[model samples]
Target: MRAIIQQFGPALESIALEHYTPASLSSSQIQLKMRFSTMNPSDLITISGAYRSRISLPFIPGFEGVGIVHQCNEQDSAFSIGDRVLPIGSAGAWQSYRNIDERWCFTVPNQLSDEQAATSYINPMTAWLMLSERLQIQQNMTVLINAANSAIGLMLVRMLNHLGIKPIAIVRRDNTLQEFEGCKLQRIININNRDDYHSLIKMKHHIKVDAILDCIGGGESLMLSSLLKEHGQFINYGLLSAQPIPPQFWLERPDINFSYFHLRQWIHSAEKIDIQNKLNEVMQLVYKGIADTKISARFSLKDIHSALNYIQTNEETKKGKILLTF
Candidate 1:
């Protein structure tokens, strides 16, 4: 079998696609033939040594993927040989085959196809948990989400709409304007890397949102933080701009409730049952086409470098994902 290994340093410096022999599966474990996976921002960030404290040396680097159980000992009633499952928790999905304990994987719903099932975990669960746990948003409350063109951002828009919370989108591309408009989203702020942040930030004068789900932190976060109503929720789940929050940011909006959500932390701390139950709920929403995703391209695992290059070139304009297959 072959796997992408991370031994040290940043991703470009650390990751390598290597062939290896697999150890025999244990009675308590199931051997899986990995089928599909996707490269996410979180995957790049971790491999780039952003979350160094949380990472261990020489580990695989992927959070979500689906696999077919090829060698099952019938230890778990929920899964058996030839079952399609997602190996949840921690990282190690960037491989051709895996020998994982039966308890760590969950059977994928028949409703989702291989492409959809591959992306079923990360974006869906992260958005759901933020709305269901951290934010105290009401149906009529106004919510603003940055990076509204990305996969997770698009999902957030739909999730908020389903909850009846008014969503104001801040996106980076103009091509997505018509797409969001088609959905009847009332407010869409389309800005570019060169535009003045203050000029585009006119939400405060028009309306005060109750909560802001910000993914692009940095100066973008600084300006957006000002638009939140007093004591509103400001949840920062990503740093797409590769910058930190300005030191004086908090002094300006001390009344705003600021918090960070890490799906990895939640996965490690929450009971397995809770994670499974939450994922099932999100899958049902996907089945209803409420939380669907798009795909821009698919690549074999061997062409990982080419895939990364494509992601960088089309990131600002691309509305879909880059998938990897064995």
Candidate 2:
């Protein structure tokens, strides 16, 4: 079987394709023939050794993928030879085949294409949990989203619209405003311009920000916190800027509630049945075109270096997710 291995060092230099033999499955495990996986920011971060504590060395690097059941242990009655499933939670998804426990895999909805199902789990689920579960946002309320041009950001905007809530997309560039062309929203703020802050402050008087979905931490987070209505909630999910929320910022925001969310932690804490139910709800929305991912590009496993380069160079301008096909 061919796999992308992260030997050591930076993403491009450390990652390479190599042949390897997959271990025989245990009685509760099933073998998956990988169809497609995505190149998420976390994957690159893991390869760069930033997530060294969670990831062991010399391992296959992908976190999620859609695959067909090629071989299954006879005792594993939950899966069959031809089922299309998402083998999530475990690493080593950037390979031709993977042997995973049957319990960890979920059947993909027929309404979703292979490409859509391949990139499903992480981003959509994160958006769903934040809006529906974590914050429990009600209709007619206004919410602010930082990094609103990202894949997850786009999903959040769509989800907010579906629930009849107002979305305030805060972006860094003027060109990003073009991406939200057809989406209904309260306002789009380009914080790159100093004048925009003055406009934002004035708008806050009429529009009470109920919550803030912040992906970029540091100064940007502090800025968003200031915009929140009294007792408003702020959920920080990503540190795209690689900066932490300063201690002083948290200390001063006594009227605002702040919390952090991580998908892995949520998955680990929830029951399997609960996770599946949430996934079903999100997928149903996706089937209706309410919440969906945009595909930026696709690459074969051999061309992973090119894919990494594209993500690195076009991080700001890329419109959607990047996939890796086996």
Candidate 3:
């Protein structure tokens, strides 16, 4: 089997494609023939040693992917040979094959294409959980979201529109405004202009936001929090700015409720049946074209370096997800 391994050193220098023998599966495990995986910011962060405490050396870097059941033990009744499934919550998805515990895999729906199933878990699930579980968003309520052009942000917009909730999308660039062309319930606020922050404050009169979904931390997070209704929630999931929020920012906003979301922590706490149900609901939305995965580009495993470079250089204009096809 071929795999992308992070040996030691910087992200670009450490990553290398090599052959390895996959281990035999235990009674509780099943072997997966990887079909496709995604190049997420988290995957790159891990490779760059930013997540050193959680990952050891010489480890494979992908976090999620879609696969076919190449082999399965008889005792594992949940899966069978030739089953199309998603290997969830396990590392080494960047490889051609993986042996994962049966509990970690979920059968993919026939309605979805390999591209959809391949990029399933992270963005969609995160958006669903943030809207349904964390904020408990209700119809007619207004929700504020930063990084509104991101994959997760777009998912949130569609879901909110379906539920009759209004979404205020804050973006850094003017060109991104075109992405929300048909979204009736969406209000695009460009933060690039100094006056847009005041525009948001003015919007508070017409749109009483119940929660603010913030992925861009640092000054942007603090500025977005100011627009939230009194006692409204501020959920932070990513640090795109790579800068920590100053302690004074929190100290200043005593009335606004702030929380952090980590998908792994939520998965660990929720029941498997509940997780499956949520995923199924999102999958149905995906099938209906309500929740869609937009692919900006695709690359082979051998071209991992170029793929990473594309994402790093075109951070602003890259409007969709990047996939790695095996």
Error of 3 at 8 (Å): 4.7
Question: Roughly what TM-score does model 3 have, to 2 decimal places?
Answer: 0.93
Best-fitting candidate, measured by lDDT?
A: 2
TM-score of each: 0.90, 0.95, 0.93
- The CA lDDT of each predicted structure is 0.79, 0.83, 0.80
> Model 2: how large is the Cα RMSD against the reference?
1.6
Candidate 1 lDDT over 171-287, as tens digits, reads 775666666744547667776734534555665787787888988889888888888888888999988788988876798998889998888788878887888898898888788
User: For every model in order, what is the number of clashing pairs?
Assistant: 0, 0, 0
Name the 10 consecutive residues with the lowest summed lDDT in model 1. 193-202
- Which residue runs does candidate 2 get wrong by more than 4 Å? 4-6, 315-317
lDDT of 3 by residue, 207-301 (tens): 66789888889987776666778888888998889987767667878887888998988987888788888889878888877677888788888
